[model samples]
Structure formats: structure tokens, C-alpha cells
Target: MDFDDTPDEAAWRAEVRSFLEQHRGEHADARAWQATLYDAGYVGVAWPVPAGGRGGTPMQQAIVDQEMARLGLPALINLIGIGMCGPTVIVHGSDDQKQRYLKRLLRAEDLWCQLFSEPEAGSDLAGLRTRAVRDADGGWRVSGQKVWTTLAHLADYGILLTRTDPDVPKHRGLTMFVVDMMAPGVTVRPLRQMNGAAHFNEVFFDDVLIPDAERLGEVGEGWRVALTTLMSERLSLGGGGTAIGPKPETVARHVAEHIGALPADRQVLARQQLGRGYVAALGARYTGYRQLSKLSRGELPGPEASAGKLSGTRSARDLADLAVRVLGDDARVAASRDGDSTWQNAQAGLPGIAIAGGSDQVLRNIIGERVLGLPAEPRADKDVPFKESVA
Candidate 1:
């Protein structure tokens, strides 16, 4: 692919840069800044115009992301809505759905959380037990629980997955819904991690009522809907790192500063590990470019995109581990010393990436089967009825 930008692309980049320079000279509240981005026609530039977007090319979207990173702007506040939920709604939502949701979503006017993972079903999302029975009035009454919810406490709405029919096979009995978070019977309790932050939460739905109009797709089609969300999710989560404290360069600087005082063999090993990490990080950057290239074409990021996720996450984990080793004593009390211990907090959260989008083993399985044409894993349960399999 030609690396050079065409004249129009260059002009678009220039426009984004100019807009940033004039509007935000320093860090700002995420909600306010994103609203400004929406007004300035910078957010969701590639989404369809009918969905309250600029109808810009995916290359334009890439330019916006690049400009935000180059300007050192804080990460967008409503990443889940813009990156995952918005795209799914654009593809599958009714006109009213699009009209009612997209504009507010882009502006962060309505924060969204995803309710897919349950205590029982996480990686195997089809095995979710959250039931949604049809009420007498033809609406749905949802009763179940979801865990590891990132922002349920702060959300105004949620894209929910439910087991609409338990008698059928697991994958074929699910349904998706757009639920109002403030409605009665919705409960969100904070989950404190070892790092002492409660960013994640557990949400319980006890007879939560979902309007008939809020169903995302036809019954027994939740998996298809969830796939759309998951496609966007892989791109979003895979693209962003754990965002923990001290970056690779910061730890490297610490290592270099203390290198002269270490024993000779120890110094050699430290330098070697550092070199390996630098190269791995460099490779991950280009792999990320490949992912962006796929996304820019408006294609759902394919299995190969997992390579980017794998490389980026592993590199992050390596850096986090290296930081702990480089700052052995400081690491011990880092979390206790400050709430903003970027490195320590990062180390604690980095392991979650292994299982976040997909575990390393899971990604490897996908790459082997989908990318390499290898033998697929045996699945005796694939076609069994949900009740039978559970029993």
C-alpha cells in the first residue's frame, strides 16, 4: 500500500489538526470535549449521515484517531458506544432506533454499557443464562445478572443479551435488547479490584422490563447481533492497551539510569530484555496499522486483526513485568503509596487483557483454524439443546 496521503487526505488531516489547536489547548472533561468533537464534525466521521455522522471516508476516521493521539488528547469518553454499539445499531437498527440513539450517543448525551458477560458465560457468550421471557403484554421481562460491566453504574442505557429460549440450542435461543438503565429492577454494584479501583461493576436485572420496540433483531438472532458488537469490540479493545501507569519508555529510562550500577551479567540481561521488548513493541505498531487499514475499508476486522491484539497486549504485559523488575522496591508499595500509580495499576490490570477480548490461547485457536486452515477443535456440545447440555 502507498504510504503517502493524497492531497485531499492531507487537507483533511490539516483540518482536524487546526480544529484541535483552536478548541482544546489542554486536557478537558471527556464528556464536554466529545460533545465539542461531535459539533465540530470530528467524531464518528465515517458513520452514515442518517445516523448523525459526517459520512467521511474511513481514512478520514483514521486521520481523526491519529490527530487525537498526536495531540496527546485524553481517550474518548464514550468509546464503547462510538466504537462498538453505534456501528452495530447503524447496521441492524430500525430508522427510529437510529434517529433516537445515534446523535445522543455520539455526543455522549447517553452513556452506554454492554451486558453480555454473565457469571457463568464470558468467553462462551452463547452459554449466557440471563433469561428474557415474553410478558403477557408482548414486551420482555428480563431476569439475570451480568458481571465485569465496565460502566453500568454510570450508564443511561445498555445493549443487553439474554437467553430468550432455553429449550433450544444455546447459540440459537438468544436475543439482544436496548434497555433503559434507570428503569425499575436494574441494580448496579461496584466491584473493587486489587488495584483499589471500582471501575468494573456487577449488574443484576430482576424482572427488568424491555419494550417490544427495543429488541435489536428477530428472536433467536441475538448471536448475530452480538457478533456485530463483538466485531467492533475486538477493534476497540484490541486497539487500546491496558492504559496502566509508566509506559515502556518510562521504565526503559529507569533501567538505563541504573544500568551502570548493576553487576555486568545482570546488566547484559536487562539490556537484552529491553531490546527484545522495544522490537516487539515496534512490530505491534505496524500490526495495528494493518488493523486500521482493514477497518478503513469498512470491512469488519477479520480474524487476522487478532494478531494486532495479541502483539499489542503481550507487549504491554512484557513492559509491565519489566517495570516491576526494574523498580523492585518501588513496585512493592506503589499501589499503596498513590492512587495514580500508573505502572503498578497497569501491572495489576495487564493480565486481564489475556482474557479480555479473547485469551491468548483463544486467539491462537482462531488464528490456527480461521487463518491457517488447521483442524478445528472438537465440539460435542455445539448442537446440543441448552437444557440437555447443562443437565
Candidate 2:
């Protein structure tokens, strides 16, 4: 793989940086800044033009991301929708579905959440029990609960995965749908995380009606559709820079300005932590570049996706811990009119990065199975029909 960018890539990077400099938010409103990026066609660079994408290659897309992070631009909040769900819909959706969803999704007109994980099903997504039964009028009646849904409270729509034919095997009996969050029988209750934000929620669908047109794929093809979503999810979640931590350079500047104001001598530890974070951040950037190169060449870096996630989670958590330690007692407080307050927010928010989008442990398993070519996780339920196995 090419480590350094070609001259054309350098030009693209400059263009993206210029856009970010002109339009990005003023050190806050990170989500809003992302919306601006989307509006500028810098966010969905790799998406096809037909899907409201810029029709750029994955490498070009990664260049945009790298440039944005290098400029310390805050990430967009609708990343899960645009990066994961939008791509999946583009691939699995009918033409009408794409026409209806992709532009709104890319433009953040309708934020979306994934309704897949349940109390019992996390990594083993096929074991999900959300039910979507065919109604007499050929619509779907969905009923179930989904937990750990990020931004569900803010979502205008959701991509739901539910069991349609339990009599079939777990992977075969499922179906995927695009459900309006405002539709009857849908409820969202935000879940408060250890971080100071309520970013995720528990979403319940009680007899919600979804037309067949909203269904993403053929009957009994939910798992296949879900694979597309998960693939995009794994790719997007793992391959980004900046994450939840204050960029190392940002931390260092803060340290210089506030060293005397902090408790005890924090300079050494803060410097060390910042150094480690920079290394990890740089490593993730290179790894993401590698993956993007592979994707541009029509290869899916499946197993290596886990490696990026593992590194990202570790880097985010470590940076948070170190920043918190460096700040000592101040980390406990919410904020004040000071630079340290920013670090506190970063500290409180960093652990969440570890837990969200397939936890660190899950990443390890993916790496083990796909990259190492280890013995696959044994499954007695693979061949059984969904209904029979559940019974």
C-alpha cells in the first residue's frame, strides 16, 4: 500500500482543509460542524453521486477525514447514520429507497438510529427477538425493544432488524426495515451514561406499522442486509482520528497555559500521556489510511477492521484516564470558565468511546477470528430453524 499520498491526494487534502477552516464551528458545536461538512460534500466523499455522495474514492474520503482531524475539527453527530446506515441503504435499498433516504441521510435531514441490539443480543446479532410480522394489508407490525441505540431520541427514523420467520434459521428468518420514529407505537427513552451526556436510548416498537416499501431487503434476508450495515459500521467506527480525546497538541497547549493553575506537578504526567496519545492517534491514522487504500482497490479489510477499533478504544480510554489523572481533583467537577474544564469534559467522555460501536472485547474477537484465522466461535444454533432454536 502507498504510505504517502500522491500529488492529487495532497490537493484534495488542501481543498478539504480549506473548507473546514471556512465553515467549521468555533471550538464547540462539533455535531453542527459535521453537518456543515456534510453540506459541503466533504463528509460523504466516498458515497456515489447518485446517493448524494461526492463519488470520491475511499482514499479521497480518508484524506478528507485526516485533514479535518488534523485541523482539530469536531466530529459530526450523525456519523452513525451517514457513515453506516446510508451506505447500507444505498447497497440494499431499491431505487426508490435510495432516492428517499440517501440525500436526507447525508444532509442530516433525518437522523437515524440502529434498532438491532437487544438485552440478549449484542455481538450475536442474529439472536435478536424484535418481531416484525406481516399485517393483513401487507405491512409489517413491529414489536420489541432495542437498547444501546445512540441518538435514538434525536432520530427521525430508524433502520430496524427483526425476526420475521422464526421457523427458519436465525440468520435466514430476519428482515430489515426503515421505520419512522414518529410512527405510532414507537417510544424512545434516553439512557444516561457515565459521561455527562445522554447520547443513547432504549427504543421500543409496539405494533408499529411499516409498509413493505420501507423494508430494506427480501423476506428472510435481514441478516444479509444487517451484514451490510455492520460492515459499514465496523469500517466507519474503527477508522477515524480525533476520537473523544483532546488531540495531543491541544492537550499540550492547554497544559502550557494552565500548568501553574493545576494541583501539584502535572506537567510530566500530562506530557507523557499526551505523547502516548499522539503515537496511538498517529498509528490509527496510518491504519485507517491502509484500510482506505484497500477499500479504494475494491478490497474489504475485514479482520483488520477490528485492529483499528481496538487501537481506537484503547487510545481514547488511555487519553481520558491520563487527562483525568493529570487534572487530579478537578476531573470530578463538571466545568468552569477555564481550559481545565475542557479536559474534564474530555475525561468524562472518553470511556464512552471504549464502550460504543462494538466494545473493545468484541473488537478483539473479530481480530482473532478474521485476522488470526483462529478457530471460529462454536455455534450449535447455526443450523437450527429460528423458531425451533428459540423454543
Highest lDDT against the true fold, candidate: 1
lDDT of each: 0.80, 0.78
User: Which residue window of length 10 is worst by lDDT in model 2?
Assistant: 240-249
Each prediction's number of clashing residue pairs: 2, 2
TM-scores, each model vs. reference: 0.92, 0.88
Candidate 2 local distance difference test against the native:
0.78
Tell me, what's the RMSD of every candidate?
A: 2.5, 3.2
lDDT tens digits by residue: candidate 1, 1-391: 2355678888998999999988765446778889999999999998889999999876788788778776667778888888888888888787899999999999999989888888889877899999999999999999999998877888898899999888889999999999999999999998987667777789999999898899998999999999999877776665522222234666688778756666788778878888887677766666666656665555655664577777777877887777666655555666566534666777778777677666688788888999999999898878999988889
| lDDT per residue (tens digit) for residues 13-58 in model 2 | 8888887787655537655555567777877888999888888888
After superposing all C-alphas onto the true structure, candidate 2 shows an RMSD in angstroms of 3.2
